[model samples]
Target: MEKKHMLQIEGLTKAYGNKIVLDNLNLTVEQGDIYGFLGPNGSGKTTTIRAVLGLVNYQKGNVILNGFDIKKDFKKSIQKVGAVVETPRFFENYSGYWNLKVMADFYDHVPRKRIDEVLEIVGMEKRAKEKVKTYSLGMKQRLGIARALIHSPELVILDEPTNGLDPQGMKEVREMIIQLSIEQNITFFVSTHLLSEVEVLCNKVCILKRGQKIEEGVVKKLLNKDYEVLDIYTPSVKKAMDCLIRDNRVISINPFSEGFKIEVQQGYADKIVKILVEDNVPVRYVIPRNQSLEDYFIEQTKGGEHIA
Candidate 1:
């Protein structure tokens, strides 16, 4: 089955005063994708989301949602889209159910049953009657997700959904996102600085830097297609280095705790072992360390110092 395009941004450009926040950026989010929108702090992520949701104006470009151009038909374009940008806000004194019911009023005809359904979907059904102020940040995040799903949207856009969460809290949120994607069949557009989370949760990613897209692809492909890093443990460190360094496939060799951390072009680890063993270099163990999204992100952004 072919996947339809859920969100498409063509030449989406935005400027503030004389500064260009988004520079003709192009992106496509396919149906059933958990798409990660990644960048450092000043990389125009917020601005782009604002433009897409029509909260802010753009200088030039098209924001297309489910084949409807936002500029031409704002209502239809955003009708089926739900967003929880930054931290979700709610009336603290109200019950979680009450808050959701209040928000449902914005739509034309949101039945009371939908409030219960969304609460159940987000695993907040048991605590539906609790006041918003009693909920933890993680619980609040879940409530926010329930609110977003209240409209039965096809796409949900979340900005730093797990921000300021503890390890367990983050885990719950991440698992919820994965489950929602699988069970509900909803496409997600998540903007987060957590590369590890993105690696685990997102299927595809678009990386930005200084308002321009630097890299975008399926996560697994990006990890495998790029250079492969290996941990080469050997008693003959100098000898192994001498033998492997001469090979053109070897990119770099640095000292790791137990051995040399060798980075080489893809599919060259076997050749490296062969050369080292042939040269009488004793190999203790050869462990292949797959390049992590964080590693790739750092390499692509040239040491992304601002990544939180």
Candidate 2:
């Protein structure tokens, strides 16, 4: 069954004076999807996010939250969405519970029980009474996520959610996101420059470059479409290299400390091995290289300067 879209962005365009930020961008977030909105420093990711939340006015486009049009029903549409952009801010002197209490007061129908529930969901229940000023950066981030959920929003949008955390903090936040998505069935649209985080946490991703979407799809499917990098170890390096070099599927080959790192088209590993064996080349081992999200991102955004 086709999952219903929780958020839809169509023909979205935003311009700043003479410069264009988002150029006719289109994206979608389906129900229960942990969608990753990815781009380089100045690929219009933040601008696109702001436009969706109605934080900035765009020259053209429509943002639909569920079935409510953001333009026509701003309050109703926005109420269903929760966002923590850049950083989550709170009164330093106030306790975590108090900070969430204050936020809950702003929205009608938000029960006190809901605040406790969200706090527990983010695993901040123990420190709920502690002052925000005394909390670590990771704790504060978890509280920020709790605040975003206080109103029971159907869709959560986060920008750089783990920007400054240490390794442990990043892991906690990542696990929390997965847990919330599973337990609460909430849809997430997160924008971040951390490719590793996106690779681990997101099932779907949209890559934007120079204010335009260059690629968008499932992470596994996208990575599987390309060749599987392999490190071929053989005593007969010269003979194996010469035999495989003639194949049209071999993309590139480079000498490694152990052997040669070869990039070959998918499904050509067996054929390459067979050729080496047929030529009486002594093959030691073949190690498949896993492609990282960073490698893919760098390849896609080549020649583009990093922008703020």
Candidate 3:
């Protein structure tokens, strides 16, 4: 059997005034996939989402939702898609259940029990009757998710879903997204600057910068650094670098105060230690810097930063 995409963008481009926001960007989210759009703040992550949501006018590109072109079947394409970009607004005075009911009213087939089911799905069953004003930030986020799911859409898009969340709140939301993807088999298009979160939740991710896509690949594949980083504090930085650079396995050496960094197999610490000891170079400490998704992102897209 062949897999199909839930959303597909080809040669998508966008700009604001003289500055480009999304330049020839192409992406796809397969059915039942948890795809992540990741980059720094100014890397056009939000812009791409807006373009995909049809919230912005793109100068050129084609977006296909299932088999329907987003431009041709604009309303029909979005009928099955639900999105929450940035902070989701709600009726402050309305209870959580009431808010969901309001969104549910937009579609007729969704039953009242469906609202209850979604509330439970987001782990807000106990807080269903509570006013939105009384809800915490995490609860509000969960409510936003519940509202999106209220209509029982097949594709869900969320932008910075964990912003302003405490550690526990972030963890909870991450777990919820993962659970929904695995248990409910939902197709999720997630846009986030949180690389660690993307690393944890997304199977595929794209890195954007200055409106241009710099890299796109599977999360693990993009992050599978061929060489690990080894930092060693020694008495002579230059000498350490010179000796380490002789090895064919070493990629590059970055000099640091009182030490240097070697990009090589971290397990070969014994080889380095032995060399230094044999050469009578005092080795203060040898450490391996555990690379995370953020580390890989920074390494891949070296110049981008949080612009927004």
> TM-score for every candidate vs. truth?
0.89, 0.88, 0.90
- lDDT-superior candidate, 2 or 3: 2
Worst 10 residues of 1 by lDDT: 221-230
Which regions of candidate 1 deviate over 4 angstroms? 233-235, 245-259, 264-278, 282-287
Q: Write the per-residue lDDT of candidate 3 for residues 215-284, one digit (tens) a residue.
A: 8888888777666887899878877777778888677788887798878765665687788788778889
> How do these models rank on TM-score, best leading?
3, 1, 2
| Model 1 quality (TM-score) | 0.89
* Residue range 1-308, candidate 2, lDDT tens digits: 99988889998989999899999899889999999998878888888888888899998989999878899999988887888877788999999999999989989999999988999888999999999999988888888999889998889999889978988888988888898899889999999877888899999999988789888888877776567688999877777788888789999888866679888998887787788888998889988878876767777777435422
Query: What are the per-model C-alpha RMSD values against the true structure?
Result: 2.5, 2.8, 2.4
Candidate 2 residues lying further than 4 Å off, grouped into runs, are 233-238, 246-261, 270-286, 303-308
Clashing pairs in 1: none
lDDT of 1 by residue, 146-229 (tens): 999998889999988998789988998889889989988999999988788889999999998989999999999988765778
Where does candidate 3 stray beyond 4 Å?
A: 265-270
Q: Measured by TM-score, how close is model 2 to the native structure? A: 0.88
Give model 2 RMSD, 1 decimal. Answer: 2.8
